[model samples]
Target chain A: MARSQSQTVSLADVADAAGVSAQTVSRVVRGSDSVRPETRDKVRAAMDDLGYRPSFAGRSLKAGRYSSIGLVMLNITDTGNMLRLEGITSAAAAEDHAITLMEMAPGETLSLTEASRRMSALPVDGMIFNLNRMVPDFREFKPLPGLDTVIITMLEHPTCSTVDNDQMGCSEMIVSHLLEHGHANVHFISGPELSISGAQREEGYYEALASRGIPAPEVLRGDWTADSGYEAGARLAADPTCTAIYASNDAMAYGVAVAMHDAGKRIPEDVSLVGVDDSLGLFVPHNGLTTVRFDNRQVGLWAFRKVTGTHDMPRGRQHVLIPGTLVKRGTVAAPPSR
Target chain B: MARSQSQTVSLADVADAAGVSAQTVSRVVRGSDSVRPETRDKVRAAMDDLGYRPSFAGRSLKAGRYSSIGLVMLNITDTGNMLRLEGITSAAAAEDHAITLMEMAPGETLSLTEASRRMSALPVDGMIFNLNRMVPDFREFKPLPGLDTVIITMLEHPTCSTVDNDQMGCSEMIVSHLLEHGHANVHFISGPELSISGAQREEGYYEALASRGIPAPEVLRGDWTADSGYEAGARLAADPTCTAIYASNDAMAYGVAVAMHDAGKRIPEDVSLVGVDDSLGLFVPHNGLTTVRFDNRQVGLWAFRKVTGTHDMPRGRQHVLIPGTLVKRGTVAAPPSR
Candidate 1:
């Protein structure tokens, strides 16, 4: 959706809402010392309510340089985000651009209005809003917020500038590899339902089945953890129809492998399997898992460049899709039925 | 090494060497504007040569409230560092502090003098330096460099306020648990020798063995990856003299499990095992990983709190040691011979 020319709110409107002087809000926006914490918080809340957007001219005149970039995420508990940030920040550092990482809870946060106010106050150049699960439809960190933003995620929201590994593509490649190896009707074990990546990957699994003219069997659900994978695998192993299985990530794949072994199914001979993220985990020869591999670090590198506009950005919303390839090891092969 | 009063380098000397004005050098140290990139570089290089220490007066006068906390990681690629930072940054967000993460290569960076110059120039209110490996013995981020700093690492030097997990105590608890269960001649797998956490855990291992009057068996080393664990396990399994195994991390523990399985030895039933850091790897089961479970997240929380001096920093040099308990699982038990 295009920005509404008429609906763009001003800093004065936010100043009016907060019952504070416009100068105080301006000081907060420019990161000046003249404002108090209580005043800043109040202005932030008001800006969010008013959908107040900072114009580049106004921001630049007050703050010397809007050269810093923001890398926003919902959760920091996952190593994936940290690793991705490593790649991005290192790249940013190499270019002498300071990165400001902002951790925000999507949807669960105190309304989009309030969130926008706080986000607008930060003096930054551009941003990378990473949505591990949920995210907004556009780069509106809050309404009418004007800044060049790139979203780093698996979600295929075509309207935004994003740089991430192709989760949907990885899913297709995973299933096709198994099907090509003579496995029929592949079993699917997925990550948490709330994840946008998980949903897209699931969709890819079904689409691949349809493309191959093979009927999709019942899919086992998982929470993207090894524990959840084990639970799902236990159920899959009990059924005779299950010949091959695919877990969304390597952790879950490990769980499924153990469950299959416990159930007395010889890998590939009885049940072929595949996983995502050819993690450092699969180097264990006993559980040498065959899966898809992609460099998330490279995704991070591209993300930094795109967000910073270090060079010319690719045209048309700019979704830089990194591909994941099937890494054939001991896990995938023809089913016994073949 | 103590600073010699007469031998101490002056700011004027540094300025002369860098071919910059004294005021220009001072501006760079305080991170003020009006300094050119080329001039800043020159000043930094000159300061590095003279071992110049920046002044604190200007910095102290400027910093009122901590807007950002600096996090200096030994290596960004280390997954433990990643997880620890995630905890630290998340906790920091709640406290209304922005994170400035610096991926520094202390050894490879410009001379320590220049390194000092670069760091002194960075204007962070407080900092968390996670020294995983053997780093410069500066004792501080150049020893206070004019701000509140907490070294959240396995630093042995008696300098800045240190806050680290009680790994030494945790290891003993784990070893005692294994020994009490009747395992004798326990084999140990360690992480990189450079890590203080690894060294502390090793110290605990040796102490437990020494007190119990058991001969110290040969040590196998790992880089804390699952693959290294497999290699270490293979070496141990090849030696029929070895029985119970303890790895530095869960990933390596899982590696050892795989190696033992391949070596025709059963887990617990044949070669009992234990690990530290409870990092639920792809192969390590929750109950099967009879390892020390410590709240590694607290290290970050404490570091963040201390750096911000949030609520008076509690008191003392504050060497916090979190207790680690064994999650009695299937991995550890008595040796078959016992």
Candidate 2:
């Protein structure tokens, strides 16, 4: 049978694209770290472009332990939780770690406590804990005690082995993306005003717009759903001068997209849009959603490795402040006439 | 500080509904084997009506090791895989066993192989092996040496501790539901026909119609996607007699709903609908899917318990079969002009 075009993009093509010899591409693709950055970037870029995604099993066999790690998104009720989880799973899978997921009843208080106890009773040595929705103030300190746990989400449980979006950093990135598109005015549609995610990301947005000497356009509220996003979009769409809007997550961004779509305003033409956590399932790539891609899968893998012996993290408070990369998929274009 | 509503529905409600004392309701709820038939039915009816669901975690601590047996589903893409997985997960969780999930890349054959190897390596004694998208010819079996592996799908891996759904049972259930609602002419939307889920469920639809001496409904193919269901629904909706449709999975049913919604028809009032697997997160539960709720979690827990226990199976060929319960919700009603 003929191989998929994605699967058939060969080692030779990857090597050629990386400007390295074929065997060298093979070594790098095999995940050998000795390759020079110039070469590594070439190979990685080539692999990413051609979608030369290595098989997890092949990688597992070669690496002894699969480059794949496990990620259990603590709950599902929170849309942000799923988005961040999507980030973790897709990023980790892209980085060649097969992500293993388990959804807990987010509302159940003791579920996580019990899940941690049971996780210790099972295999899969390392795991990134996506305690997204059920962030208990005192609960974080319990420390799935014996297990190596890396916490994701800003609501730091009592313990500190965690990785969170540079809330401030992300807001800055979106604002900067808007600024690059020549929009002096950029508004932030923050998540539920009470949430830690809302506060941190909002702070970043305010700082970014303020530092640039451009008045922050306006503060609008959203609850992280597409509906809330539509409301935010409707508000912004009503404004004659509003040019760029950054939603807290993709659902909101989708709502914004729908609202924009309804208003007959072409994206990046009438107004620019930016969303956090490149969520895969809900919105289509066909929508051309300009998003800040957080490598959640990588975050998950990195956290898992930290918990297990694969990746070393020095003791004391440590974190992986994974930066959000702006995905310029044609959503951000020049703003309309001022 | 109050317990969650799902966890704390009382014996009083059960008693009130059954028109009996709370003590009698409590005894019946406990599944005491010696209850009077009339009293038991009254109590059972009351429990079901009041949503007086059982609490597995509270009582099953008496069972020794792994009272909470998790069925780790390595595959996550296919709706069938998820349904069977949900069946096992729901069953196990209901039976007081925890369900640990693991979703692997279907694209990575090696990862899948490695995942099976690792799943076998896990401490879980028994499990429902749902071959989501992978079809097997029962070739060289990867010996899952010790684990009581319940091969759920038709993919013949080396099997014991297996549970094949009563496909005919499900089909009869749906056909009966449609017939009860006065629809003699029903149409079918099946899953990937090569897979067991599609075949079994579709078979159920066919057998019921045939057994009733009615002509078999015209069948359409769907890959279990809302879009495919949309395509199928659009085609079906155009027909004036497309008064009844059976989608193979809840996702496809959702698609059918959207297509019907777009086609300007009320569900059940215009076209009575039935689907399999009351899937979670595919869409909001506004359309309350009338599906074959295969209590997968119980299956997972039971399978896990069976595998991990001292239960003796006569070495050669063995498997377990769990029944799928008919979950009648808002999807199906009498066909138009009935």
**All candidates: DockQ:** 0.11, 0.05
- Going through the candidates in order, what fraction of the true interface contacts does each contain? 0.26, 0.05
Candidate 2, which segments miss by more than 4 Å at Cα?
Answer: A1-73, A76-128, A134-149, A154-161, A164-295, A309-318, A323-338, B1-72, B77-130, B134-147, B154-159, B163-184, B237-241, B253-294, B308-338
Instruction: Show pairs that collide, candidate 1.
Output: A48-A113, B48-B113, B48-B114
Task: State residue A42's C-alpha deviation in candidate 1, in Å.
Answer: 47
Candidate No. with top lDDT: 1
Give model 1's DockQ, 2 decimals: 0.11
Model 2 alpha-carbon miss at residue A40, Å: 43
RMSD after CA superposition, every candidate: 17.8, 18.2
Worst 10 residues of 1 chain B by lDDT: B55-64
Mind giving the per-residue lDDT tens digits that candidate 1 earns over A36-85? 88989989888656645455334433444445666677776665676677
Consecutive 10-residue window with the lowest summed lDDT within model 2 chain A: A55-64
Q: Over the stretch A1-338, how does candidate 2's per-residue lDDT look in tens digits?
A: 22224223556777887788878987886678788878788787877676563332333323334333445554343434444544554444444444444545434564555565444333334456676554444363544433456777665545657777667888888888788878868878889865776788898888888887887766888987777888788888888788888898877887787677667787878988889877633232244578877655455545655555443557655766777787767678888775
Give candidate 1 misplaced runs (Cα > 4 Å).
A1-63, A105-116, A136-146, A156-159, A283-287, B1-66, B105-107, B110-123, B238-240, B281-287, B314-317
Cα lDDT tens digits, model 2, B1-338, are 22223333557767886788887886786677777999999888766565553322222222223343324443443444444444444444445444444445446553334555555323233444555444343344543433345555433345454556666677778878878888867888988766666787787788778877888756999987777887898899898978888888776787787777777888877888888876533232234678887755555444545544533534554555567888878778877674
